[model samples]
Target: MRKKVVALVAVLAAAAAGVVVARGCSGDGTSKEARPANPNGEKPASGTSPEDAPRPMGSAVTIVVDASAPPSEKGPEVLFSATWGGSRMNELGRSRPDEANPEAPMSLAMDAKGNMFVLDQVNGRVVRVGPDGKPESVIPLKEQEAAQDMAVTDDGKVAVLDRFNSKSIVMYDEKGGVLGEVPLEGEGLDELGFVTGVFVDGKDVYVEKEHGPLLRIGTTDGQPVDRTEVPGRPTRDGLSYIKAGIIEPEAGRMYISSVDRATMQHRYTREIRQGSEIRGILLLDTDKTGTIYLATLLVQNDQESVVLSCHEPLKGIPTGTAVLPVNTMPEETFRDMAVLDEGGVVYSVRTEQGVSYQKYDCQ
Candidate 1:
């Protein structure tokens, strides 16, 4: 089986001619909501290959966020409604001299129970929204730290990753209480900006090191630990670890593969061919049923848009796709997409009006 994939790699390499590694958030962005670009104005038929066809192709979720910004407790300063921002009043870093940018939310998260948690860093609080779309509560955060990323445990505890100030992961309970703080300043995790993701796998709290393997940094209780044996991002099923990567720069191509957690061997690899210019991978994740979801930024005909696609876990065969509008550079969500354990993804979109979340589900 490994030999077969190696042979496929050879063929792909030969086709590339000149290959270069590439990684990024997205390329030139547009404020307008994107629609599928089809000369016939129709989705690819079922007979189309996995590389072309996406079943139930690009079905838009009714949960589309309105173009106008909603109001929040922080007043209608023009960012997000429930999530506060754009003000310098009572900030933890207000005393600093070089403050330039307005306060905004850093990342997004959704717990298993279906509640949404927006990392409202500027407000120094995490806004919790119920499934019905009402603001439920706000989780207090360490004011001294400017949180970059965040993750929630299975039971609903929140962990915010602060890279510059505290250099630690502050844990919070489901009821908005502080659990503990796991320091991120030792050993394989020291250097500045080395850690990228914060995750809670089972009883342990893990962080991704350079988007490679998952490092066990502590427990869900915020107890610190130094371990680096995690094979990859552990899937919800606990049987495999999934990874996505770009193989060719000039060519719009990416490979998604699953690795057996126990053996640490590749289960399957599927290289999906894409647009004329590949911007960057926006989201790589899975739902409860082990169905893989991928969102990429691709440019064709000088127009850039995000393509959201889903794949089967067994062989990386694409299940479906949806072309989504992307905000022009200066991404408001930092670099994280919140994938709900139940079924879909929720990501914030920024425009001149304000910020709103775009929600989509895998069909």
Candidate 2:
């Protein structure tokens, strides 16, 4: 399989054909969010594909966020309210810096039970917050070490990318005890660079390999499962070409969103509905029923950009049937996003002030 993929890549290179790779909280900052030009300078389709007809986005209501009124300990400052049977935004909690560590969160992940895990990059610790918005445990790391991304399994195993200390990934159990650590170099993965994405689906964990395929590791003992390579435009990283990606593993299919630096466009997999106006997909997540939610950026102009929360159906078509603009400051950056099974979406919006989390309840 690897040989076949490599051969296919070689053929694409010979033809100058564009490929798709996949992104996350950490990005390479080479993508322009507005719908980009076709890399091959060819028109593929309009808004719909021939097999699956296009569906108009029905009326979906959403709340707007006030940029001036900052989030407080009581809750985040939400500007608007949702009508009956519509989605409403709710504030979870906020943190402040302390002498022991900077409590600011860098990345966010959620488990099946709705427990949230936060990577405090400034403090070099992982804090698990229960569904009640209270701290459960604070797992510390080596001094000066920081986590780039993290993933949590359904059984309560947490895997964190400890980049500063030996470029290793540490795994911890439910009680925040160390299970084991895997160094990227020991195995046959010598070409691997900084891991930018980590995802936990069931008993398996997938880690993004810089310029390489997604490494699937078994959660039981942290052993190798296999590698998945998605072809796409590659960027020259030093002397080696690397592709930065964001990955989400569902029951059967994997959703990948990547940046194609060759054409300065953002790309998604062919499985998705074609001609969606996402421009750039920053976060990919699915609910328990297999509904896909995308936190995307739409660049309107050089000075204006809008972040959208979109919902795509699983079977009828992959196009977003309902879209909501996250009515925040155009300058606010998207940090992370997660979809709840019962019916809500949690995402982080960051600015110079700090990071704030807002939840939209569609239930």
Candidate 3:
């Protein structure tokens, strides 16, 4: 492959100065842009200075879809026709079945090629939609009755988590071929009920245990590993692991912390004081360049909205923020937001008609 003329020119300029600058991809075949990651792994003090102040912004909708049943080519897909499709809520606004949420498509994922995978669990299939908002194909999962969340690798491999009924994680190839299925219980994981989300890094499969530690359960081939665990969620670049928490819940203050993936040493913990009534954090993940993306559900004046904040890599420096509208008209959903390898996010919302997947460039 021929190098870009601009890259070659840049290399020559650097070499003329008696220094050879090497080009390196961040393990995703894309060059890692020079980011302001702290070189000394300094643990910056947060929540007390202007550097840790929050910067919030709003997001513009990129895609919208009306709900439709299977065998249709016009939608992200939904299953609201049957009597068992609705989730029951009481006067106190609590689900009767406890953790068994609802029948909507609980999760969504996107491949490196910008293809969307909607886990239509109620319909028993994974709906594939391209970046152009066109339906591509369907990956059927007839046996996943209570699949909670799913993650897709950069190469279009999929790992579906069915923690309730199946207690298993099923792996699938790009063509919807069954690679393997493995149990969730292992060394770092003990209870299936506490498993929160599924994540993919390289060939390894990790399941977040109750929003805490991530237990490396298996691989892309659907075989269980020997029960290794990570302290937090691994970034796509495989260089850092990040964990986030809401410290002053009432004041909407939060902190994002990370450690080096190799040495597991402290990197930085930056606190952000969001100027909204934050209900909770909705999403947290990184792009291929390790740029951090966080979504928090903010409520003010009895209205709830999702506020997205973008930060630079492991340093946790604020880049920008945006507000994503939340579907007040609730359907049963387990996962909503998915980050892209190229610094964007696509999230799904289920309505009375069908599920609509929308994209936002909060990064």
List clashing residue pairs in candidate 3.
57-321, 57-322, 57-323, 58-322, 58-323, 67-354
lDDT of 1 by residue, 1-363 (tens): 000000011122332222212222222422232222110001111122345422221111211222223223332111223322343321111111354544456677778888878776766777787777666777778853568788887778998888788888888999988888988877677674767678777888887765556778888888888676575677776778876655543456555667888788767655554534656667766777777777766665687666666666665655555445566634334444667677666766655444566576533
Across 204-252, the per-residue lDDT of candidate 3 in tens digits comes to: 9988866657888788999988888788889888899887765545555
lDDT score at residue 325, model 3, on the 0-100 scale: 59
Model 2: weakest 10-residue lDDT segment is 1-10
Segments in model 3 whose C-alpha atoms lie over 4 Å from true places: 1-101
Question: Which candidate's TM-score is highest?
Answer: 1
- How do the predictions measure up, each by TM-score? 0.72, 0.54, 0.72
* Winner on TM-score (2 vs 3): 3
In what order do the candidates fall by lDDT, top score first? 3, 1, 2
